[model samples]
Target: MEQYKGRAIVQKIAAGRIWFYTKEEQSVKRYRVEDTEKEWKRYEAARDEAVRELNGLREKAVRELGEINAAIFEAHALMLEDRDYSDSVKNIIETQGVNAEYAVAATGDNFARMFSGMEDEYFRAKAADVQDISERVIGILSGRRKRKKMGKEPVIVVAEDLAPSETVQMDKSKVLGFVTRQGSSQSHTAILARTMNLPALIGVPVREEWDGKMAVLDGVNGLLYVDPDEETLENMRKLQKEEQERIRLLTEYKDQETVTKSGRRVRLCANVGSVSDVAGALQNGAEGIGLFRSEYLFLEADHCPTEEEQFQTYRLAVEMMAGKPVVIRTIDIGADKRAPYMEGEPFHLEQETNPAMGLRGIRLSLEKEELFKTQLRAILRAGAYGEVSILYPLITSVEEFKRAKALLKEVEEELADFGIPCGKVRQGVMIETPAAAVLSDLLAAEAEFFSIGTNDLSQYTMAVDRENPRTEEYFDSHHPALLRLIEYTVKNARAAGIPVGICGDLGSDESLTEFFVKVGVDELSVPPSRVLPLREKIRNID
Candidate 1:
């Protein structure tokens, strides 16, 4: 027995015997036969059986994991009925004169490859789902299947990977946790593990000969202790209890305000990307939308979003937020987040050798004034429904903010000319660059508010790309230099009588909660799930 390490998806702890699930594929004989109809019937029967099993799993998931998580099975059910997937299997069986098992196995690989080729990480993970469902059909057709009954006690599931379908279908009661060799923090397996509140570790090294081994899976620190000594087990028990107690304590602050011991109030808000996230954020007790990433609308579209398209999206968000202030960031493109449609002609950002430092954010908008104005018009129209404040991202200079503001004014004049009723929208700037932090006083004088984008500032100040894992050692957000920049920006923003906030991954870092509260930070905008935990941290700190 040996210890293994991996990335933790859900923070929890469990000690159980390993239960290895293996999918053994059968070699189906392929030949030219006139029995195409027979092969079709065989494929249909296997598909129907798979769907029936999936529906049963969906029901169990709803009972144990809740409806949102159970939807993964529903999607699997739909995929079985979807013509694109089903028809492809049928076509391959009929045309190639192969058995249902071989047809599905071949078709699944082809379809999964398509998703794996895509840029978006979300869609890339969906490829696993496609393959998982196909494997079910193959399993039935090849006369191989999972055990109909589970063991008496729950066991730790060790696998190469667990797709959404496989994850939802597993007997949750008999599965204490999961240990996988391949998966990311954002994989569907991770998401489901979080939903089920199960301890899970991914990216563990593959071990072909470790079945029935007793292992203490520590999800909090992402370590797996195989055949641990009594002392190790005792230590892990204490840590697990502490973690459970911490979670219980955090639940008490789900609806509490993030006021420091000094009685200074700090706004706890969520950085949402779309309207879909608004409901979850509110459920997690988000006071308001501190950063509405408006770039997703542009990034997801095939071309530039039309004024009405952008208007409706923004309006839905504002209306959903009700009276809460929603700081909508302007359409920030280029860099990692690129609008492929603007690759040529007026915007040749695709050719940038270093897009990370090239024309992006406010700089890109200033170059394409029309694109910036279209978004401004939509944001202003949305402002009519609620407290919608505009924030320009990647503002390194006062001149960039000034020019963007002028275009916004031009959009307002045009909207007014067209008999459109708009509300007064407060303009703000994102201090994401070292230069911006240095010029915060000048920017805050003109801007109504400031949201510090620590992700960018740390990268720029340290000249290390936070996205690159290789540079993670050097990409320290807690660097004294970075903190000083944040402290200075907060002071400058306060001097100009403007509210200052931090909107980045670091916003939820508990270690920095006291520091942020000390520096007179007005708000902290983090992911929806962090709203309550961060609030608890702030409320406990002065």
Candidate 2:
């Protein structure tokens, strides 16, 4: 028996034979080209073909996964059209008089290295994206592009690493789980695994000899057992059966109300990143849309989205909810989620040593008044479609909250003056900072409701970087000080006659569900997949 440990992305158990995933390797070699223009034309043709392939993949992804996942391919397509990237490829081909394939390979390497060297984890993970697209174009140029194939029976896939495009193209039904030698939690592969609810592990050394061998993947304990002993195999099978039973039972709570044994009812909502997530949320039996992360609009684009674009997107989500309350948090940009255009134009966000604590969230919104007003107007316009509420993120002081509300009011009047129809939006504040939690009493009196962003609150309170693996031990979410802050915020909200909810990752913690319910938490918003499981926990609570 051999035991290995790796980080788990999805907490599940699977037992299957190992199937080593292998791809046709293409080695690009530099060769002198007689006609530089001809070589550039060949590269352009291959790039266009790659874009077409990506468009097809995007459509397929939308049918299988939701639009949120499909958006990855959209970004890849945009990358193909990027002027800087194309210029680099063209310049390399024309200057060096090299084959198109060699130029493309070099450009991809340079860009991937640049992204890998970034300090931000989010940007660092983009290295894989560059490699994926570059390899895709090269494959097209070399006539070596091929889709991965697996046998009919399910098996655990072992690989060095997986690109987002490759992961999406695989036969999902035949895949029991995945084990990779290299990947990050922020990688698209990890995100896809979590979305598909497949047991996945990264950073495990894989051997070619292990192919066709029986293995057990325990994602919950972050262990992979290859050629395990009989006793260990039996225990794994038993655990797998129990997990299946738990999932089967969770489905029974889909339509049931999220109420405690003592008859306390709490509104269970789903936090969504984009309009595409609304369908998944409803499918998971979410009663409302909570913490609609609106920043994705800015993150996914090269330029800031227009007011109409934002309005149409918000309107679709609101209409899809069919009158269920939709709490759309305004765009929270800056820091790790920066766009090139935001750094340059009307919103000049200078580079910061410590971006997380720097000008971001509500602070950035208030500083860029026109940008903030554009979003406010869209939210108000979308409100006319259904029940919509506005939630502000990273508000640290009463004055910040007041200034935001005042701006919103100005936009409302602007719309009314034009005789444009708009719906009333409930203004709320997210208690993400320690300062915000301490001043929740005063803010609650002015705001309509409160949502505690425990993710940032814990980070700020413990003075730890949640993204840093070195600080993982110190980034305690259940510390008494953090709990006290939450309790205090809830108490103040109650005093102000307003409802308080938790929308951060902590909201999905089963162990803390009881604590939240006992403390008069009015709502708990989490990912769509967590809604039913959380509802079951809430019902079992006394």
Candidate 3:
């Protein structure tokens, strides 16, 4: 038996036969159109057909997969209806006199090319979605078969890449796991696996010899075992049984505190993005809400959300927590994010070559004080309902922390003068940079609390973008240097007598639970689905 290593996106274990999948390539042929008006009509008709198909797929996906999976087709429907996409195709048809199929292909290629050239990997991955949507329209225009060839029995699908639309159409029951050569944690394929609770490995090496072979997809370690020996197979069975039992055992601790065997207690919280997720958190036994990402409010709106609108949302979260602490991270938008609502003239998101290091997080908030203050006032007012803490993201220095706090105080005093009811709220900063870890001593001295934003911390410290597929070979969360930075940040917070928590993706990892506990991490905030299991793991730790 030999192990093939890859980056694990969904860390679950599954043993199954391998099924290699390759999508049929669509041929793009340029042909002249005799009538531009007729071509335009054809394109419009195809687009309408595409939208209808997407809507049908959305309903089927909701019934079979779930709401989140169905949302993919919903997005596809929106893309098909987008004026920008339609305008591009219409212009090509009218100006160049190209046939509908050729016009669609050209416009799709241009859009995909734009996305492919983007610096952000998430945006880069979206090129496939654009192509997938165009292909569907083209297929409608040309009468091509577009259905996927799924297996009869469950199998682990190995592929080069799976587009969002393709992933939505997949048979959920037959897909045991996924091993893709081109994908990241943020990719749709990975997201689907995560939602389905399936093992998934991305950036897997291309291997043709292992097809139809029995293999163990060890997603926890990102290893693929091809035709394992008797002893190794037995060990894998034992481990799988233990994991199943652990999951079954975790249900008993649904309402219990996360106290270790030696009586060490830590607050277990859930990282939520929207109000809808709050119920899921409580259902999974989250003691509190650790990280409430506030960027969605901005992203979801055409303009800046009013203080009243933001207040209503924040209040809902605060009241839902019901006096339990809710650390709401202020808008962490950046140039790389390129939010749809913020794409217009008033919002000037710079196109930086290194968007990750450019204007983002606290920097953007400090610069766009008007937008930032709206959220501050809303959060402060929400605190009046229940326990609400403000968390500033990507704080790299003492000055940024102080400036943000000063702004918070300014808002508080402004509200006080107006006699607008606002409560005393705790303030904190996300330690997500190398400098932040090095200078945690200075920042923690002033902040009320700290949350280690491990995703950014890993990216900035290692100088590696986890979203980028090329960096998969070198992106190691278990790297000694990254762990030390986390340790250093935790140590400084502990010495300052302020609570510190890890609110990054790595915090949800089951293997690191003991390491975090030993380092005196005050809390572990993860996704709602992992809260119960993590609590169980914490309870099992000595």
Candidate 4:
């Protein structure tokens, strides 16, 4: 066997496949192969256990109440209990499975065909899992034992893409870095790798022949060297040492307040979606969580999170932030983020051509008062722990603001009736749509604050779908119309005497910081990395 020694991160564990990246021809390549038999068997046992547990879950879901639909839960059960799936293995075992490995490989192919046409990506990926699981089951049936894929030599995992679940399975000690054939730095795999303090490089090219090789991965500078000469290897080691030192220097500054030389202090807050992300924000020296996208509480849970559950989540975030201002955006669910518990036919069945203007953001929240109320109560109850503010999203009309505020009032009254002292939770609206911007003056009068969601504002103002690659060119945040809308919202907020903040990707943009300052936004909240740079830029601005 040819051995190319280098660095790699373990991205996935399935069907004895160990994928890694190496730069052989001025490009990265994804290599994969069969892991040892023992590792394969261990994973197989785990799968069987999971399958059994999942089946039990399905049965219990029917007998008891679940957050998600019982029917949906049962579908997973049916998949596990599929006759065709189990029978394929049974048939293979009856014939001594030829080679048990070969028989399991055949079963994988069969399951893939059966699930290939399914619409869900999760289920489709499950087919691959089935293949892995079946391979293990067959191995167990045939009594094959082997070792795990951890090697003493360092390796850099390279793949076309790595899922979050796959990324978490990495053996950190053996993984030097990760280089992917296709991925953006903002993707989940990259983010997870960064959080884990591992080197990760994406957007590399790959091929099948790269299997069982070594490659030097430089995630800091996005460089990958495959099968390099002695000189190149030595140089890389030196560069790695320098990079580590630079990171160490940066770490010392992380805990310090992000103050500019000119004495302009901007709140460097983290934008988070989950409670687990609290540590990342604090580690990055976030003054507070500027935008806590609370959708995970609703979306991750099978059913709508109860008022108490929502309260606990907010409480945890508040505790984590140590009373820093946490701008909790109300459940930002929409046609794009459909909830089974919410009112609305299947989103796909009656999708609007103009979903941006359709049932989304605050519009959908109003339709589902129960869902909205549950979130509001949670925020209010949690307010006792720390500074929590409610940010309403996708508000298009003055009436919608009035109605939502009235509901808030109702919630406050209900809390009072129970002798619970609801904390002072300020209310605000996201200036996202064109209508919201145009009517910002009126909405600002009713709302406590304004946060310009530039992503949607740019889309609505420019009349461009950001998702469409063909029209991506027109989807600039710097478009004159978008700038004007931002100017308008900031102006309106100033007039209403309410604090206004920019919370979108544009907020952190150094190029736009000056313009946003000129437009007179009270605050600018960006990602953790941009905090210092943007602060520096603003400090330099006269």
Structural similarity to truth (TM-score) of each candidate: 0.62, 0.71, 0.65, 0.63
Query: How many clashing pairs per prediction, in order?
Result: 0, 0, 0, 10
Return model 3's CA RMSD, one decimal: 7.8
- Candidate 1 residue pairs in backbone clash: none
Question: How well is each residue in 289-348 modelled by candidate 4, as lDDT tens digits?
Answer: 778878756655443455766787788899989978899999776544543323211111
**Candidate 1: where are CA atoms >4 Å away?**
1-4, 7-219, 223-249, 339-348
What's the lDDT for all of these models?
Answer: 0.79, 0.84, 0.81, 0.64
The best candidate in terms of lDDT: 2
Worst 10 residues of 4 by lDDT: 8-17
Off by over 4 Å in 3: 1-6, 13-180, 184-199, 204-245, 296-309, 416-419
What's the lDDT for residue 409 in model 4?
A: 90
lDDT over C-alpha atoms for residue 470 of model 2: 53
Q: After superposing candidate 2, which stretches have Cα over 4 Å from the reference?
A: 7-10, 14-35, 47-216, 225-238, 297-306, 338-352, 417-420
lDDT of each residue in 1-542, candidate 2, tens digit only: 99999988789999989989876666888899999999899999999999998999889968965576567788889988899899999999888999989999899889877976888856655666677688889988887875445767899999987755456546667899999987655444665575456899988998878989999999989999999899998998888899888878888889999999989999999887667678889988999998887886666543456687688789889999999999999988766566544543445678899987999899889988877999999999999999999999999889898999999999999999999899999999999999999898899889999999887888899987654445655766689999999999999999999999999878988889999999999999987888999998889888
Better lDDT candidate (1, 4): 1
Model 1: ten consecutive residues of lowest lDDT: 339-348
lDDT of 3 by residue, 1-542 (tens): 88889988776788888877777556878888779998898888889989998899889968954675466688778988989999999999989888988889888789978876888855654565677688889888887754445658898888887754455446666888899888777543564465456889887786766678888888888898888888877887888898888778778889998999999999999887667678878887888999987875565433345677688788988898888989999988774454432432224576778877888899988987877887899999999998889999988889999999999999999999999999899999899999999999998899999999887888888877755787756778788999999999899998999999999878888888899999999999887878988888888888
Model 4: how far is 408 from its true place, Å? 1.3
